[model samples]
Target chain A: MTETWIILGATSSIARAFIRQEAANGSGFLLCGRDMDDIAATAADARLRGAPMAEAMAFDARQPDTFAPILDRAASLSGAVSVAVFVGSMPEQAAIDADPAMIAGVVTDSFTGPAQFLTAIAPMMETRGAGRVVGVGSVAGDRGRLGNYVYGASKAGFATYLSGLRNRLGRSGVHVMTVKPGPVDTAMTWGGPKQPLSTTPEVVARDIARGLAKRRNVIYTAGIWRLVMAVVRAIPEPIFKKMTF
Target chain B: MRWKEMELAGWGRALKSTAAVARPERRSALAGAAAPAIGNRRSYGDAALNGGGKVIDMTRLDRVLELEAATGLLRVEAGARIGELAQLLAPRGWLPAVMPGTGFATVGGCIAMDVHGKNHHGAGSFGMHLAEIELIVGGEARPIGPDDPLWRATIGGLGQTGIITAATLRLIPAKGRTMRVREQRVEGWDEHIALLDSSDASYTVGWIDATATGARLGRGILEEGEISDASLPPAGRSRKVPLDAPGFALSSPVVRVFNAAYYARVPAQGRTVTRAQADFFFPLDRIHDWNRLYGKRGFHQFQCVVPPAQKDALRDMLRAIAQSGLASPLAVLKRMGPGRAGMLSFPMEGYTLAVDFPNRAAARSLIAALEDLAIAAEGRIYFAKDSLAGAAQVRAMYPELADWQAAVSAADPDRALETDIVRRLRLRDPA
Candidate 1:
C-alpha cells in the first residue's frame, strides 16, 4: 500500500534524513514545522526525489490550533498514514536552572505538545489498522545525568507516554516504535565536543526505518547506546550523582 | 561529525587534523557558520582539512532546489552528492555534464577541486559545466557567474574564495543507465601511454601496475568506456571491514600480489561488457571504508600531470614508484585535454598519472621525489590529490596562482574559509 508519512519537526537533521529515504521509496511527506521556509525547501526536495505528495504546513507544538488543519490534510489522502515525531528542543541546563519557567517550553517542545498531536491522530491510525507511529526518545531519557537532567526528564516522560500509547494502540493492529538514539550529529547536539561514538542523522534515520520494518517496540541507534544506557541505568544514585559526563 | 573538535582527514586520511565542525542541515544555516564549508572531502588530501580551525560540514544540506527539463539545468545545495544527481537525472535522460571518478563527491567539492573525470577528454573539467555559484563570501551570499572574474577563481579556488552554498549546473543528455566498458591489457609503459593517447572512446583510463619492473613497468588494464542504452545487473550488497585492519594488511608484498591478481582478473584476451554506471564510475565504492583495508594510518594518493613532451619525466616517476615497492593497488594514467575552466585547474594537454601508497616514510619520500619530477617537467601536481607539495613548488607550477590569491583575498578578506591545503600551500600569497 502507498504510505503517507507525517514528519514533525521536519527541519531537524534526523527528520530531513528520514524524509529523503522515504521520498526515494515514493512515500508522501507532510512536512510539519514552524520554519515554513525550511519546510518548503524539504518539501520541494521530496517532490524532486519522487515523493508522490510533499507539502509543508506550519506547526507549533505549543499551539493546538495548527493541529486540525494538518490532520485534515493528511486525512484527505487515501493510503496508510504514519507519523514520526522528531520534535524536541533543549536549553542549557544552567539556563533552565536559572529560569524554571524554561521547563514548560522544553516539556511542550519535547513532550506534551507532540503527545497531544499524537493523541489526536491515534484513533485514525487504529482505525486504519496498519499505520505506524515512531517516537524519538534519547539515551538521556534512560537515566537522567547531572548535565542536562531537565531535558532528560522530559524525554523520559515522553518515552513512558509512548509506551502506554503503544500498549493501547497495539490491540487495533497499530504499531508504535520508540527510538532511543545516542549522540546524533544533528543541530540539537551542535556546539559540543565531537562525540566519540556518535552516529549521523542519516544513520539514525536508517535505524528508525529498520525498526519500523521489523515492527520493533523499542530500538537504539548504534546498538552500543543500548549497552551504554544499560550501564548508566544500573549505577546507584549515590555513585551517579558524583559522576558527570 | 558536527559541532565538535574532531580529528578528520581527506579521503587519503594520510594527514590528520583536528577541527571544530558544524554540520548544518538547513539552507538558512549555511551562511551563518563562521567557517569554511566542506563537502564529502573526496579530495584524497588535506584540501578539505582545517587543522586547528573550524569547518562547516555541508553534506546534510544536500537538496535539489530546482531542475529545468527544457534547459537541462539543475540547481542543488552544495552538499548534494554527484551520484545522487546522476541517479536522478540519468533516468530522465539528463546527467551532470562532468562527474568525477567517485560519485560520492559533492557539488561543492567538485567545484573546489575542479575535478576531471574519465570523459574529461571530451567534456572538460567539472567547472566547465557550471552555470552559476552561490558563494557566501565575507559574510554575504552572492551569485557569481561566468562573466565575473571571480567565477574562474571560485571554480578551482579550493573553497578558498568562500563557502559554496548552492550551484546551478548545466547537465547533458544521458543515453542510459549503463556504461559499455572495454578492457585491454597493455604490456608496458610505452603501450599504456600509446593506448591512452590514441583511444577514441568518450572515457579512457589505464590502470597501471606500479609494482611491475622494467619491461612490465606500467603493464596493467586499459579501460575505454562509452555511454550506452543497455542496462546491467543491479549492484550487489557491499562488504565492509568491521574493524581496523593490522598494519601488515596492505604490506609491500601483499600489494604486489594484489595488483598482479587484480590485473590478471581481467583476461589479456580483452573483454567488453556492460556495467551499472556506478560500478564503472566508482569501482571501489562497493567496499565500504576500503581505506581501513590499508589499516588505520591511511594512505596517500600522488597525482601529477606532465606535458605531452615530458614522457621521459613521467617514465622516471613511474620507475621511482616501481622501485619504492610501496605502491597500492590503485593507480591510473589518463590523457587530458587542455579544457580546464579555472586558473589553478590541473588539466592540460598532457598525460596524468596517479598512484597510491600507504602512509609510510618511504612512500612519503617517493611521492616527494615524484613531486619534484613533476615540477622539473614544468608540469603541475594536482592540488586535489596532493598532501606533500611545498609552497614554492606549487607556486612555480601554477603561474595563475597570484591572480587566484588576489581574487580570494578580495572575496574573503578575513580568510575565514581557508582550509589546511590553502594554508599549507600558502595559496593566498603569491610571494
Candidate 2:
C-alpha cells in the first residue's frame, strides 16, 4: 500500500516541513487546517519542495464530524492513510484565564477532539492491521511548567492517553507515537519568547519523518529535549513549586 | 512471583519484572512451533523477538562436537555457551581468540553480532574464525561455507539472514594458563594515545574515566597483557556469583567510589602472572544485576571505532562527554585490527571505545554529539550496541551498506528475515 500522511494543521510551519520530508521520502499526503486558502498555498509549496502528491482541505478539530468525511475522501483518493500526524492545537498560555467557552475550545481542540478522531480512525487502521498515528505534543507535558501549565496539562493527558492506546494496539500492529517538541519556530509561536536550543520547523519535520520510519513510540524532537526534560522532571516537587521556570 | 535476573556474565543483575519460563527437561512438545527459537538473547537489540512467532529456546543446545588439539580448531552447536568453549579449550591449551567480555554468550549470538575482543587488533572478529555455518532456511537444513553470500550476511547479520544451527570456529593455541599483565595510569588524552603506541602486548586496553574534564580529559587506567607459557602460583579461586544482588545496589556514589579506587589501584610498574581466564574473560560476570545498578531506565552500551587518521576526533568525543556532565565510569579503549571481509563488520585498524551509560534523557543528546564527532572523523558506530542511531546516519557511515542490502535482497527477496535493528536501519530498502 502507498504510504499517505494526513497532517492536521498543515498550515503550521512544522507541519509544512513534515509534508516536505514525507514527500522527499516518496510518501503522499493530504494537508488539513482551518484556512483552506492558506493550506492550499502551503500544499503547493510542499509539492514544489518535492512531496510526491499534496492536497489541502479545511478542518476544524473541535468538530468531531469533520474527521470521518475527510478521512473517507482521503482513503478513496489514496490507497489508505498509512500515517496521521495530529499537529493541530491551540497555543500555550492562549487559554489561561480565558472564559469557559475558550477553555472548552482549547481542551477539545487540543486533547479531547484528537482523541475522538483517533478512536474513529483507529478501527479503520485496525482492520488493515497496520498504521501509525502521531500526536504532536510538547515538552511542556514533561512537567506542568508555570508559564504553560494549562496547555501542558492537556498534552500530559493526551500523552498518557496515547501510551494506553499504544499498549492496546501493539498486538494489533497499529503503532502510536507521541512527539514532544521542546520549542519549534512555527507559525503559532512566531512572536513567542525564545528558548535555548530551540529548533527550526524543518528539524521537527525531519525528526517526525525519521521517527515514523523507525516506528518509534515516543520521540523527543531535536534529541536534546530528552535530556533537558529528564533533569526538569527529576526536580523534587517541593523545590520545583517554589521556583519560577 | 518474579525470579532474580542475572546476565550471562553474572556482573549485572535485575529483578525479574516478569516470571522466568521453566526450562523443559528436554525439548518441549511445543518446541518446534510453540516457542520461538531464542538463541542466547545477548543480541543487544530485538533480534530475538519474532512477535507472534514461536520461540525455539536454543540456549539449551549446549554441546561441543569436535576439537582438534593439534590444529586448535573446534566445531560446536549454535547454542553452546562461550564460557563452556573457554573451559573446554583452556584445559587443552586453546582459546577462542575473538571472545566478548561475557563468557555466557552463545556461539550463534557471537556470530550474529560478529563480536570482537581485546585482541581484535590482531585477530579481527569472531566471523574470521568461522569455517562454516549450518542453518535452517525455509524449513530446509543447509550447510554454508565462507564462500556463500549468506555466510557473510549471517556473520554480523544480527540473526535476520537465517537461523544459525551450528558453527565451525577456529581456535588458537594458548601459551599457558596465565598471562604477563601490566597496568599503568595515563594522565591526559595525548598520554593515552602514547600508551597505546608504546604498549607491546597481545592485548591492550585503557579504562578511561571520561568524567575528568579540561586538561585531564581522558585520564584513566591503561592495561596490557600477553599469554605466556611460564607458570606461576595460581591467584586464588575464580569468583562465582550464585545470586543477584539488590536492584538499586550500584548507586552513583558507589560507582564513583569504585571508579576512584580502580584508578588508584593501577600499578605504575607492570605486574605479571595473572590468570588468563580471570584477567581477560568474564571479569565483570562476578556480580549479577550490574545493569540494574543503573536503575529502571536501563543502559546503552555505546561503542564506535575511529580511523587512526581521526585520532584527534576520539579525544574530542571524550572531552565533549566530560563537558556534558554525564559521567560514564565504565569506558574502555582498545586497538582494533583491520576490517574483516564481513560487509557489515564493525572493526577497523584503529582505536575502539565502548562505554556504558545509564539511559538518561540526555543520553540521546550525548550520544548524538559523540556520533556526530565520530562521523566527522570518518568513523562508524557499532551496529550491535546501537539503539539511537538513525538509518540516515548509518547509511552515511557504512559505504558498503548498499552491498549488504543487495546481498540480503538476493538471499531473501521477500525480506522475511527482519528484526527491529533491520527495520531501524531500513536495511531491507534499496540503497
Candidate 3:
C-alpha cells in the first residue's frame, strides 16, 4: 500500500533522517514546519530520494491556526495517513529561570500544541482506519530531574496524553506509538558535554521504524534507556528530591 | 545553526584539530558565515580542516534542488553524497560525470579537490562537469558560473574562495546499474606501467602491493571496467570496524601476506566478472572506517603524479617504500591524462602512485623522501592526499598557484574561507 506521512517539525535532524528512510521506501510526505525554507529543502530531498509526492507547508505550534492547511494537504494524499510529531523546544534552564514567561512557549512547543493538532487529526485516521501516530517524547519525560524538570514535565504531560490517545485510537484500528528517545546526536544535543550513551539520529529513526512495524505502544531508542529509565523511575522520592543530576 | 565545539580529522585521521562547526539545514541558514566550508572531510589531509577557527559543515543541507533529465543538469546542495547521487540517477540512465574513489565523498568535496577517478584518463576531473555554483562569500550567496573569475579558484581551490552552497552537475549517461570488470595480475613495475598505458577500458586502475620488493616490486592486480546493461542485485549491507584495531593489525608482515592473498584471489589466467557499480567504484567504502585498522595513531597517504619521463624516478621511490617496510595493504597506481579542470587539480599526463603508511616517525621520513623524489622529477603531490608537503616545494609544483591565490584573495579579501591546508602551505603568499 502507498503510505503518506505528515511529519511535523520536519526540519529536526531526526525527523529529516526518518523522512529520508520513508522516502526510500516510496512514501510521500507532508513536511510541516515553521521554517518553510528548511522544510522545502527537505521536501526537495525526499523527491530526489524517491518520494512520490512531497509538499512543504507552514506549521507553528504556538499558532494553532496554522494546523488546518497541513491537515487539508494530508487529506488529499492517497494511502495510509501517518503523522510524526517532532516539534519541541527546550530553552536553556538559566534562560527559563531568568524569564518565567519562556515556560509557556516551551510547554506549547513541546507538548500541548502538538497534542491539540493530533486531536484535530484523529478523526481522519479513524475514517481511514489504517495509520500510525508517532509522538516523540523524550527520556527527560520519564522522570522529573533537577537539571531540566520544566522541560521534563512538559514531555511527561505529552507522554500521558499519548497514552490516553493510544487507548482511544486503538479501538479505531489506528495505532499510536510514543517514542522516548535518549540523547540522540543531533543539533538538539550538540555542543553540550557528550552523553555517555547517545545514539545517532539515523539509529533513532531505525528503531522508530522497527517499533512501528511491531505496533509497539512505547519505545526507548537505545533500548538500554528502557532499563536505565526504569531504575530512575524506581528511585525513592525522598532521595530523588535531594539529588541533582 | 547550533555551533558545536569538537575535534575533527581528515580522512587520514592523522591530523586532528578542535574547531567550532555549525551545520545549517537550509541554504538560507548558510548566510552570514565567516568561515571555511567543509563536506565529508575526505581530503585525507588538512585541506578540509580549519584549525582553531570556525567552519560550516554542509552535510546536513544536502538536497537535490532540480534536475533536467534530458539535459542531465542536476542542481544539488554541496553536501549531497556522490554514491547516493549515482544510486538515484543510475536506474534512470544517468551517473555523475566523475566520482572519486569513495562513494561517501560529497559533491562539494569533489569540487573542492577537483578529484579524479579511474576514468580520469578519459572523463577528466569532477570540476569539469560543474555548470555553476552558489557561493557564499562574506554572507551573500552569489552565483558563479563558467564565465565567472571565481569559478576556477573555487574549483579545486580547497574551499578557499567561499562556501560552496550548491552546484550544477552535468551527469553522464550510464548504460546500466552494473559494471563488467576485467582483472589481471601484473608481474612487476614494468608490466604494471605497460598494462596501464595500453589498456583501453573506460575505467582503469591497478592495485599495487607496496610491500613487494626486488623483481616483484609494484606487482598487484589490475582492473579494467566498463558499464554494462546487465541488471544486478544492489550491493549488500556495509560492515563497520567496531573498534580501533591494534597497531600490529597492519604491520609490514601482515600487509605483505594480505597483499599476496589479495593478488592471488584473481586467477593466474585473468577473468571477467560483474559487480554493482558502487562496489566497482568504491570498493573500500563497504568497510566503514577502514582507517581505524591502522590503530589510534591513524595513517597518512602519500599520493603524487610524476611526468611520463619520470617513470624510473617513481620506481626508485617504490623501491625505497618497499625497503622501508612501513607500507600498508592499501596502494594504487594509475595512468592519468593531462585533463584536469582547476589550477591546483592533481591530475596530469603521468603515472599517479598512492600508498598509505601507518603514522610513525620512519614512515614520515620515508614520505618526505618520496616528496623530494616527486619534486626532483618535476611532479606534484596531490592536495587531497598530502599531509606533509612543504609550502615551498608544493608552490613550485603547481605553476598556477599565484594565479589561484590571486583569485582567491579577490573572492575572499579577509581570507575568511582559508582552511588548515591553506594556512600550512601559505598558499596565499606570492613568494
Arrange candidates by DockQ, highest first: which order?
3, 1, 2
RMSD to truth, every model: 2.8, 22.7, 1.7
- Local distance difference test, each candidate: 0.88, 0.70, 0.90
For model 3, the stretches where C-alpha displacement exceeds 4 angstroms are B231-237
> What TM-scores result for chain A when each predicted structure is judged separately against the true chain A?
0.98, 0.91, 0.98
Which candidate's TM-score is highest? 3
* i-RMSD of all predictions: 2.2, 29.4, 1.9
Model 3 clash pairs are none
The model with the greatest DockQ is 3
Cα lDDT tens digits, model 1, B1-431, are: 34677788888878889998888777676655558888888888898899999989898878898889899889888999998888888888888988888888999999988999998888899999999999887777889999997899988888888889889999998889999999998999989988888899998889999899998998999999988899576678978878878988888898889988988889879999998888888888778778777777888999999899997898899898889788888889998988899988989888899998888999899888888889999899998899888998898899888888888888888888888998888888669
Least accurate stretch of 10 residues (summed lDDT) in model 2 chain A? A185-194
Docking class of 2: incorrect
Chain B TM-scores of the candidates: 0.97, 0.87, 0.98
> What is the two-chain DockQ of model 2?
0.01
Model 2: CA > 4 A from native: A1-245, B1-37, B51-54, B229-254
Q: Across residues B1-431, which tens digit of lDDT does each residue of candidate 3 receive?
A: 67888788998899999889887766677668778888988888898788888888888777888888789999998999999999899988899999999999998989989999999999888999999988888778898998988888888888888888889999999889999999999999999999999999999999999999999999999999999988676668999999999988999888889999999999999999999999999999999998889889899999999999999888999999999999998899999988888888888899999999999999999999999999999999999998988888898799999899899888889988878888888998788
Residue-wise lDDT of candidate 3 within A1-245, one digit each (tens)?
Answer: 78899998998999999999999999989899988877887898898888998999899999999999988887887689999999999878888899999999999999999999999999989888988999999999989886787899999999999999999999999999999999988777777766868999899999999999999999998999999999999999999899877
Residues A1-245 of candidate 2 have per-residue lDDT tens digits of: 56777788765666766765676566777887676755665565455434577777767877777887777866575455755555545555645565545666666767787788777777777776766788888898889877877677788888998998898777788888899998875445533555687898778878887887799999998899999999999999999999886
